[model samples]
Target: MSLVSINPATGEKIREYEETSQNEVEVILRRAQNDFLSWRKTDFEHRNNLLYKVAADLRSNAQRYAEVMTEEMGKPIKEGRAEAEKSAWACEYYAENGEEFLASESVETDASKSFVTFQPIGTVLAIMPWNFPFWQVFRFAAPALMAGNVGILKHASNVTGCALAIEKIFRDAGYPEGCFSTLVMGSDRVGELIDHPVVKAVTLTGSTAAGKAVAARAGGALKKTVLELGGSDPYVILEDADLDQAVTACVTGRLINTGQSCIAAKRYIVVESVAKPFEEKLLEVLKGKIMGDPTDESNDIGPMARHDLRDELHDQVKRSVDAGARCLMGGEVPKIKGAFYPVTVLADVTPGMAAYEEEIFGPVASIIAVKDEAEALKAANDTPFGLGGAVFTDDVEKGELIATKVIEVGTCFVNDFVRSDPRLPFGGVKESGYGRELSQFGIREFVNIKTVYIR
Candidate 1:
């Protein structure tokens, strides 16, 4: 099937791309392998300088790139612009810190001299997602390139234009031609690419099933893989928490990226003493959010990326409510032209309900009331996904204690909402997938740590 970019806002076809032929794919792999030989040999300073150039290019054309992303994926123009800026930040961050991060280190050994050096693992295949289209790919690209590994991006089908633009950004920055290339193809073709001799490792930021598939293929080939998958992250509120701050943060956290983020707060677990007040404040705040066209600067919430997603989230909400959950406010789909689901808030969520178990990838939040902190923690940990979780409490010690007890998550935020930063390592545990994606640890994910010993 042909890859097509459809505007989810108006259901218009923005562009169409033919899948890369098998022969062309082989040629691309060979060229990438050849480029890696020269590219990897380049000094760190040169690579860092080129990456800085790429960041500059991205910032210079941020508006144009944002518009393309908005048109292709229906993300609000403002958010799209921010996404591009974030990509630039990732590029510059890696450019600035990569050398030190990858520098060899001395270790004590029985031999006279011993050290461990980081080396580039040939070509890497990046199977990225559509949500945060530019940011997702750039985060992987920046660190991998800085670590001396070449990248081949197989981005989401709907964001092909964004993918091509990213490739152009790198080329414009004066990097070698094959240092990074966008492969316009279907999901089925990924296994072939993973098994190709030129491709040394694979990294994916997508659904759990997709991550598992690619990881299995890479494993069979004896190549390393990194998988960043989904989450139903919890927002836990203790009785001693700042009720007002927790409520406001919950609204923003749950609705960020229109609630499409993997780490978006899907479950709200509140201690019984503050549950009623929290729910009241949450409903009050959500009522004022403006939903309309993403291009409008005044709009707070835009449509989901596509109609099918909006419909799916709506159905999930409906099922949750029917399964004995109470709709506190805005449960039905909003009366709008585009793929818009209302900013919904559901309460009285039980463990057996679908919303409690599933990740609602839209502006929907499920509030589960608990009798005490113990029950709150139990409810929070009762999910297959453990990407992230947040705790709000005035007592720092109490918050830290609670955070430590909530096992299975890759990261936890004490008295704060969860967010991804370039300076911190980000990933998830359990079904959320394995492997780190940012910071010093992230840059080393695809590199070879070779140990040397001298007699």
Candidate 2:
């Protein structure tokens, strides 16, 4: 069977790639294992220099990579470029910091000299999603590779072109023959890949169901797994918030990546006293957003990654409207060609509605009005997802309190939209999956923390 890449913006097939057979998979795994043995022995200076070259290559050809991504998965050309640059930043961050992050730590004990050393664990399989195709893989690859582990990527079928392009970046940067490889196949092969003896660990960035399945499979193999799964992140707008600032942050957060991001703000929990004005400002901004060809650069929103995904989001919006939510604007699919869905707004969202319950992975915003801060906090934490969140308020102390102490999420922002940075740890709790990515914490996820006591 072959994996087909489609231009989601035009509903046309871009290319088809033949799937990797079991024999080919074995060869790749064996090569990766061999490379890892030597790669793990490389000193920090050599690894760091190679990664710096990789980062330079990423920035130099970012636009070309962006074009490939835009063609394959319907990401806006601008956002695609930004994604490539961000991926480069991750490469540099890990390159500069990996050695320090993994340095042995001395611990006083009864033994003469006790310390913990981080060591590379061989091959790691990364199962990545289509959205932010380049960034997701680099975030995992840069850290894993810098920590001395080789990577075998099983990216989403639709973004196969992107997966190959990323592989090329590392290959051209003087990395060894088996330092990185992309498997152009469907999800059916993931289990076998995880079960491979050469694969010492697995990391996945995708849906919750997929995470669970991979986690189960990897667990059966006694291999470690780090999952970055689905998120229905909430933005709490307190009564004391600056209406203008709140609307801008909320709209930008929700519409980012056309709302395909797992950490994109999905729900807006606003205190009732300011709900009307906030909604008015948000609608005004949404109305001005242009939805059209992702290649145009003028369009503010592009189509969902696939026709089926767009239809699924529409179904969720329709279900919410039918279940008592009020549609303020843009609920229907556009008549134009492609998988485009217009910027949609739903207000009065409450329990039992699809918008309130499930993640709407499109450019749709759900507004939930609350009686006060207490109710707003309650509504924010009502969901099963604890990925990321944001709080907007003029009262800095209160906003900080809500962001730092009250919200039950892995990361929180005060008066700003939630974003993943190379300097910070990004992940979630509860159903959004466990384990962290980025920062020092991320680089250590795939390593063996060995304890040594010298007498």
Best prediction by lDDT: 2
For each candidate in turn, the TM-score is: 0.98, 0.99
TM-score of 1: 0.98
Give the runs in model 2 whose Cα sits over 4 Å from its true position. Answer: none
Model 1: C-alpha RMSD to truth?
1.1
Q: Write the per-residue lDDT of candidate 1 for residues 337-367, one digit (tens) a residue.
A: 7788778899999987889988889899999
Q: Give one digit per residue, the lDDT tens place, for model 2 in 1-455.
A: 99999999889999999999889988998999999989999999999899999889888888898899889988889998899899999999988899999999999999999999999999999999999999999999999999999999999999988998888888989999799998888998788888888889999999999989999999998999999989989999998899898889988899888999999989999999999999999999889999989988899988899999999999999999999999999999988899999999999999999999998898999999999999999999998888999999899998888888889999999999999999999999988999999999999999999999988
lDDT of each: 0.90, 0.92
Predicted structure 1: clash tally: 0
What lDDT would candidate 1 get against the real structure?
A: 0.90
